[model samples]
Target: MWVRVTILGRCLTDGQLALYRIPRTKITYSNIKYDWGGWIMVGLESECGNGKRKSGGCQARCAADGATARVTAWTHTGIVVCASLALVIGAPARAGTDDAAGNAKAARAPVKPVTGRKKPAQAAAPATPPAQPGAAAPATVSRAWSAGPGTAPAPSAGGAVSPEVAKMIKFAAFDKLSMKGWITTVPPAAESIFQDPNGLRTALAEYGIGYVAYSTNTFTANMLNNAPPKPQTYQGQIPTTYSFSEVTVSYDLGRLGLTGGQLSVGTMLTGTTWEPLGPSGAKFANLYYFQSLMEDTVQLQAGVFYNAQNYLGLLVAASMATGPQALVPYELGLSRQGVPAPGANFMINLPNNFYNKAGVQRSISPDGADVEQQANPIGLGLSSPDAKALFIDEFGYKTFSSPAQGSVWVRAGGLYNTSPYFDFSAGRKTDTNWGFYAAADVQVSQISSAPYEAYQGYYVGGFYMTSDPNKNMYQNYYEGRVYGMGIIPGRPMDQTALIFGYTTLSKSALDFQAALTGIRPFGDYASVTVSNSFRLNPGVYLMLGTSYNVHPSATPRLKNSLNFMASLTTAF
Candidate 1:
């Protein structure tokens, strides 16, 4: 057991104080009159005095005059004297063990009447000043202990266990943890939230693999006249056109270790325009009637692709297709002829020069009208015939990086005809041709961030036919050969060609894109093409373009011919 006591008044040396607690059978007292004026333990006191007002048998008296004393008990020891001063009785006056002599000396020195100074009214019992404004109240402290099986330890102030810990404890006990929220956009700007989800959807739809285009071609021919002082010329033409567009929708089933893989199918339409490369100049036999060597076709394909990061990706596809013949003019005919002999039955003689010119030489006819006359006997359709062919094409591509920066991609593929569709005279021979193609593309940018966008990229491509020994045949008859011609040739039988292109996009007050493409037949025809597109607003665009064909073997005066077009496009 522990005990505590407090006195309300001051004490003089030699004074005493007592404390008591009733019914405990123990008495404790203290002498308040010492050097360190506080409680001191005295012997147990016996209860005495009046029945109601008790007094102590063991009492402590002050040793000096004017000294104050108080006593409390552990068990009803005595009356507690809380006065500031009390007369001493039978007490020491010398401040030591001697009392009588000390009292005598004090009496002799203080005989003068006590000065009327009312003892400084005992200093108002030292007060506990009212709490200062805004002061922090004393913190409450609690003490608790638990004795149970598997109980947790109590937390301490300023300890490792925190309010956050308590919250987590409650959450862990009653709720499921979850995180759901939107990530705010940064670089706060007008379009910061313009995240273009559609663009992302489109990209994702393409999976990771992409495509490239390629084409190549060449031309050849020879002509001779045998009369002296004769006017002679050689003419040949081959035109090749190919257009490919593919949109793929793919989903990644990551569980299969094929994260970047996808399935894609697309459509490709190829057509070539070919005419005689001559002084008269090559002209589309059907252009006057708006009939272009144009053939539109659709292909249904499916394949798997793998993209490792954005750095590289590849695709392999097998496709079955049906459309206009890839190769043109199902049948072909070649012939040499001598000038017809003068008509002896003429009623009158013609110019002497005419007769001499017809007699001196067995020369091939420049127009070959006689060949066409003899060829009609075969009853095969010429350049003007309509027929479709079936074939399968295998395609693949490897892309190096994102299109935003410089990137290189390689593409190769082959088209194989599944039917016996080639008959030159029947306008189907070009249908049997097949070929391989490849190309590369690159882009450079000025700013990597946003706001101002600018970039440039260029592409080069080539393609070679495997079975078509007459390359110029397809170029001269484009509509007939939809799959295997690279360019229009100046003459017959040329087998190879190449095409190069460049494009640039820039943003200022307005956004614009421009591109230039050129096709060259190894030794014959050449053409320069230009295309441009501009944004009129957020979702509207305008396009304009033109192409000029130049034939070196044609009359230099008529080497260049133009084709132009314009269009408006909109997006939702």
Candidate 2:
């Protein structure tokens, strides 16, 4: 007997036949017999015949076809049953392996059956081994298993994140930023004294709520008065002290699903020991505000607040220079420092570091100190009948590269104050006042690579301001300064500044001064100031400086004067 047995229409190799103990018998006669545990008759044409005598070749063909069909069907049935059992038992174990390793990539790949696994609640489809098209028939055993419709799929250990979740994660990262960028330098202190010991501070920051508080005290004394028109005027040359303290709370609106939005509420307390410019008393300053940033290109702010630096002068606000050299001399009726009022401001960032900004703030009393006391005590008073509206706009360009690469800021702006002002020469009340100003600051030397050394580099800066001589006491103001940061080793947060200033007094002011003193000042006023500011720790700061003025006539009749000043600042 010649028996050619195959599974799935493909002949088995010799190894497979031997493993199954299937005999490989060959015979020339059609009638042949093979015996296993029981005597079995095969290749018997008569048994397969349908009541007709057939040829030997026909009989052989018929017998072979019948045997092949029976064997193939039986082999397929056995394979399917065995594969289903393996998949049902091994799925849980394979899922466990994938989850423990946290390999999302592996989990996505085609699954393979392995030994020792829990049976799935629902049965999977018959396994299908991978095979190439147009290749020999596949082996009966399969390794790949796929879950049926009712079967629950395994959860991912570490997998793809949704777009919404990714965006939120990114915003949270930027929400709780460190203040190192705003600080000229960060001290060596590990943490602030106000830091919460219970980790509540950090926890709140993560959720977008934060707190800040700081205080600054400044003192100035006129050391020498060259000429005193009135002997009683120079009686004490008493020292004057100005103090300002503020506390603020900020909340990120992103937690409420409004991205790039923030709400801040703050209050400032201000006082002065002596009166050179004030009704002087502790009063509340404007500090409540709402801010929104749109796609890093535009920003909007509105509330009872003030930001002078944003309107016109960057160098003057940032410089360590003190006294006259630091003054930009804009109209006082507009929004001035320590005199906050209701306002709205906007900024649009342009390409190549260019930007434009504008603002409208309610004008307060011209007297700086009186605004917070007599005019707007709680930053909400409108009792001052002299109050008007202030409009300001500016265009600027800036470059802020790495500390070692240097930075530059240049800007020009104008302000229009609707408040009435007395003409200096005519002594007549004017309807409105307007002025223009420009300022620039450039890093003049290479900087060091220190964590606290952001603006810590040599710098040169200047500012110019001009107004109508008839209406303004100072017709024109000019100031130039040079700054050095971290000049002393181990004090990377220290800064020193040398400043020079010139002011051309209006004719009316000169004439009025001459009438009172019986002598007219010859030339414009000039001042030279040198100052040093350094940080003692993360929360403490100190500044010391001396200023010499020539032909100083803004207030008391003085041909010349020398003044010394000091300031202390603490923050949390």
Q: Residue 245 of model 1: what lDDT?
A: 17
All candidates: TM-score: 0.26, 0.62
- TM-score, candidate 1, is 0.26
| Model 1: residues with Cα > 4 Å off, grouped in runs | 1-397, 400-405, 425-432, 444-467, 470-472, 475-524, 551-559
Candidate 2 residues lying further than 4 Å off, grouped into runs, are 1-193, 196-200, 203-207, 224-236, 277-279, 314-330, 367-372, 449-455, 512-523
User: On residues 295-354, what C-alpha lDDT tens digit does candidate 2 reach at each position?
Assistant: 447777777665553455432432211222223333445544455677778788899879
Error of 2 at 549 (Å): 1.8
Candidate 1: deviation at residue 249, Å? Answer: 11
- Go through the candidates in order and give each one's C-alpha lDDT: 0.20, 0.46
